[model samples]
Target: MSTPRHTLAQLCAAVTAAPVLLVAPAAVAAPQAPPPSTVIGGERLGLPGVQVDPLAGAPALPTDLTGESWIVSDATSGDVLASYNPHARLPPASTLKILFADTVLPKFDRNAVHRVADEEIQNIGAGSSLVGIKENLDYRVEDLWRGVFLSSGNDAVHVLSHMNGGIQPTVDEMQSKADALQARDTTVVSPDGYDRDGQLSSAYDLSLFARSGLRNADFRMYCATREAMFPGAVDKNTGQRSSFGIANTDRLLGKYPGLIGVKNGTTTNAGSTFVGAAERDGRTLLVTVMHPASYQRVYDETAELLDWGFASAGKVRPVGRLVEEKQAGGEQPSGQAGGTAGAPPPHPAGAPAGPVAGSAGDDGLGPVGWSAVLVGALVGAGAVVVLRRRTANRAGRLWK
Candidate 1:
C-alpha cells in the first residue's frame, strides 16, 4: 500500500503532539559541514552553511590577489566581509609571532628586566631574523616586544618565551590560547614562528589572532611604531652601552593612508603573509593575506581587500561567522533564549546587550538558515512536512 500523504496542517499537529526530546540544544545543533569551496585537506575552513558572499552594493571583489588564502573583516563587528580560501593551512612564518605575543605579552611586566640566556639565542634557526640580542644582556620586556614587532626578531620571541617559563611551555600555552580563541587552524611548534615541521596557520586564524592581539594597547603600540631604539648589550671589549634603531617591517604602516600597526611575515616556504588594519571615516577594517607569490603582493592584496571592506561594511552581507572565543570547559555560548549553559550572562539592567559582533551573516543567518528563533519557528511547521516527505520518498525508493 502507498504511504498516506499528510497535509501540512496534519504534520504540524503531529509535530506539536509528539513527545519532545529534552537533549541539550548543542547536541541537536551539531556543527554543519562547511561548503566545499571553503574546505582544504578535507577540513572545512568556515562554519557549515555559511556562504562567503561579496558586498551587495560595493565594487566587485578584488580578483588580483595572488595568495593561497585571504580574508577581510570588520574589526569592530567581527564580520568577515570577503575571503578566499580563508582556511587553507600554510606556513605562518613570523605571522605566528602574533599568537606568541598574545599568549605571553600579558604574563610579564613590560617594565621588568630579564637576563637573556645563551641557550635562548642559540635556539633561533640559522639565517632567521634577530633583534641583535646578546647573552648576558638584561633587556626590559618592553624592549623585547619592540624587537619582535619592529624587526621580526626570532631572538626576541625566544627571550620572551623563556621568560614566560621556557620555550616548550610557551609553545604549549600559545597552542592553548589559540584553542580558546577558536582559531582551530593554528598549530604552533615554534614560539618565534620560524619554519618548523607542522607549524601552520590559516589566514582566518591569523586574522583572529591579530584582532585579539590588537585589543591590547601595548600590542597596538608595538606594531604601529615606525622607528624605535632597541636596547643592546654593553660591549665587553669597549665597556660602552649601545642601542640600535629598529624600523617597523610592515611596509603599510606609514606608507598606506589610514593604515595602523599590525604585522608582516615572509619565509621561503611561507612566501609572504600579512595582517593589516586601517581606519577610514571611523570604521576599522582588518585584512589578512597569506602566502602571496611575492612579498609586495601581500601588501597590494591587503590594501585592495581593506578598501573593499571599508566601502562595503554597511552594504555587504556576511558570508560566514568568525567563531566566538570559547570559555573554559569546551562549551560554546548558547544561542538560545533565556541564556542556558554556555550562553552569555545577562547584562545589567538599562545596559544594552548590544548586537553580537563577528556573527556569520548580517541577520546572523546566511541564505541557508534563519537569523532568529522566532523566524525559524514561523516556518518550522512547513519545514517539518517537507522534511518528512523527503524522508519517506527516499525510504520508498529503497524498498522498490
Candidate 2:
C-alpha cells in the first residue's frame, strides 16, 4: 500500500504532535497564492514549489541536489526532517556495516580482545579492504569496530561475526536487529556490506542505524577518528611489520561543525553510499546517500542540508498562520498558523521526522528483489493503518 493518505499538515501533527480538533464556527475561504519559483543551484528555475500555506506564504524549497538518493534527520530524535524517495532500496555497499556495527557493538565487550582467526579471513582476499590482521593476532573489540568503520574492513566484519558466532548466525542477528529497529527495508546478506545479490537497504534505514550508532559513545569515537593504531605483528611473507593506520572516509567531519562519524561504502554494483551525521545548536542531523555519481555528492549535499537547517528557527505562530486552512480538515481558520505560547513549532510540510533527506530508486543498473523493494511500502502502509485506527479510537473516546 502507498503511504497513508495524510495531508501534509495531518502527517506533521500526527508524527510530531496531537492535533487540536475543535471546529471553527466560520470557515473563511483563504486564497492560495501561486507557488513561487524554486531556486536551483542559486538560480530561480521558475518551477513552482508545492504550496504549503496561504497566510504564512513560505517560499519554495530549494531544488539544489545531485544525489540519486539521500536522507537528513535529527540525530537526537530520529525524526526525518527532509527526504527524497526515502524508502527506495539500493545497494548499500560498505554502508551496510552500519547495521553490522549496531548488532555487534552491544554484544561484545569493547575492551575484550578478539583473536584474528584464519577462518575469519576465509575467502577474503587482497581485493577486500583489511585491517592487516595477521593470523592469530589479538585486537580489542573497540579497534575492530574502528577498523570496520574507518578502514571499511571486510575482515573486521568477519572477525566480529565469528566472535558473535558463525557468519550465518551473525547475518541472522543483523536481520533480527534491523527488524526490531523498524528498519524494515534493510536486509543483510553478508556481515560486511560486500556487493552480494540479495543484499540491499534504503537511506531511511541507514539514517535509523546511524542514529542508533550515535547513542554509543564508543561507536561514535570509532567513526570520528582520522587515524588509529592497532597493536599487531609483522607479515611473515614480506618480513614487514604492518602498521594498521586507518582513516575515516566520511568527508563531512572537521569541514562541517557538529560533524560526527558514520561510514562510507562503495562497490562495483552499488556505486557509492554514505551514512553521516553532524550536530550544531543542540540539533544533530543524519545524512545518508546511495548510488550517487561520485562520493563527493554525498558530502556536498549533506553540507548543504546542514546549512539550511541552521537558518530556520522554531517559531510559534498564530493558528491562521500555522496551517493552511484548506488542508486543515475544515476545523481551523483559513490560511492561519497557530501554536500554543510555549509549544515547539510544528515543522512545515515536506519536513519529515527523520533525515533531512532520503531517497529510493533503481540505481539505473539491474533488478532488485521485489520482497526487499516492498518492505518499505508494506511497513509504511501497515504502520499507518495501525496508528490511524488507534488514533481514531482515542479521538472518539475524548469526544464522548
Candidate 3:
C-alpha cells in the first residue's frame, strides 16, 4: 500500500506532457463542421472513428419504416447502431412517457400511497388510454408505476402529476428536468405522450431520454415486468370494485432473449413507438422507433436493429457491473446535477436547421447533458449508445 511517490519535477513534467498530447489532437483536428453529405438536418453526422464493414451482411432493413424516424443504440455505451431519419419530427404517442418516467422516477417514494383524483380523470377527452383507476381509490406508489408502464394509462400519469402537485406543475417539473438532463431537442406538452399540438421530440432526443430512464434500478424492473396482479380494492365511484391485470405493451419481452422493460407508445397521429432492451451474452442493445407504420413495424424494425447490432464488429461486451460506474460516478436521473457542463446552449425550439442523420445534436453541442442515474436505470440507452458509436464508425455513419 505504500506509495511510489513522484518527485516535484516528475509531477510537473507529467502534467505538462499530458496537455501536449491532449491539446495536440484537438489542434490538429479543430472542431470544424462536417461536410454537407454528412449533414442531414444541421448537425455533423458521421462515425469519425467507428469500425464498420460496408459489405457486412445484415438483415434486410425495411425501407418503408412506418415511423418517420427511428434509432437503435448499444445500451451499454450509448452508441447509435442504426437509424432512419432519426431527427425528423414525428408523433411520439405514449413513447413520450419515457421522458415522464425518467423525470418522475426520481421523485418516487415506494412506501408512499396515492389516491386517484376526479380531476385526474377529467378532460382526457377522446383517444386517451386509461387503466380504469377508480376515483378516490388509493394505491401504492409502486402500483401507480406499474399502471404507467405496463398499462400506458393516461390517468396514471395524471395521478402522478396530482401526487407531484398538479398537472401544470408536474409538466413544468418534467420540462425543467428535461433541460437539466439536456434533452435539448425535446419539448414536452403532455405527461402521457398523448400528442398535443406543440409537443414534439426527435428520435435522437428519445434516445437521450431512453438513456436517462435506464439509470434507475426500480424503473428497469418495472419496465421488464410482463404483467402484474392488482391489489384487492373497491371502486369509490359507482361502488364497482374489481381487480385488474396490468400487461406490458412492449411485444419484445420474452420474444427476445435478455430483453428487459423500458416502455412502448402509440397513437393515431404518432403512429407506433417502442423503446425496448435486450442483453445477449453481456452486451445490451436499446432499440426505439417512432411513428411506425403499424404495430408489427415496431417489432420488425427493432428486430432488424438488434440483429445488426449483435453482428456488428467490435461490439462492446457487457460486464457484471453497469458501464456508467466504470466511466462516471452514480447514474443520476434527469434531476441530478452531475455531468459535463459548459455544453453550449441548446438548439432553439423550431430551429429550421435540423440535426444531421447520425450526428448527436445539430445545435453544435456534443452529447447533450444526460443524467447517468437515468441512463443506468434504462440500461439499454447506455448499451445502445455504446454499440451505436461503434457501428457508426464501421458504416462511415453516425446517429445522434
Q: Once model 3 is optimally superposed onto the true structure by TM-score, how far is the C-alpha of residue 161 displaced, in angstroms?
A: 0.6
Model 2 lDDT-worst window of ten: 316-325
Model 2 agreement with the true structure over 1-400: per-residue lDDT tens digits: 4467656555555534422211111221112222322221111111122111212433333466766676555665444445565556788988888888888888888889877879877876347787666667778888888778778888888888888888999999888777655565677898888878888888767877787777888888888887787666867798765555667767776778878878888778888788878777787777777776676776777777666544432421111110111232324344333222222222334433222111211111112222232332334545534444443343333212
In order of lDDT, best first, we have 1, 3, 2
Best-matching candidate per TM-score: 1
Ten contiguous residues with the weakest lDDT in model 3? 318-327
Best by lDDT: 1
- Candidate 1 deviant stretches above 4 angstroms: 1-56, 235-238, 333-400
TM-scores for all candidates: the values are: 0.72, 0.63, 0.65
Which of 1 and 3 is ahead in TM-score?
A: 1
lDDT of 1 by residue, 1-400 (tens): 2335666576556545652521112222222322213222112233322225654466677767688888888877777777777876799999999998899999888899988889878757988998899898789899999999999999898888777888899999999998887776788899988899999999888887888888899999888899999877697899999898889989899988898878899988889999998889988788989988788999998988887777776777665556556667977666511112232222333332332233221222222332232232234644433443443343333212
Q: What is the Cα-based lDDT of residue 292 in candidate 3?
A: 65
Q: Against the correct fold, how does model 2 do in TM-score?
A: 0.63
Clash count of each predicted structure = 5, 33, 58
The C-alpha RMSD of each candidate to the native structure, in angstroms, is 11.9, 19.5, 18.5
Q: lDDT (0-100) at residue 280 of candidate 1?
A: 92
Whole-model Cα lDDT of every candidate shown, in order: 0.73, 0.62, 0.63
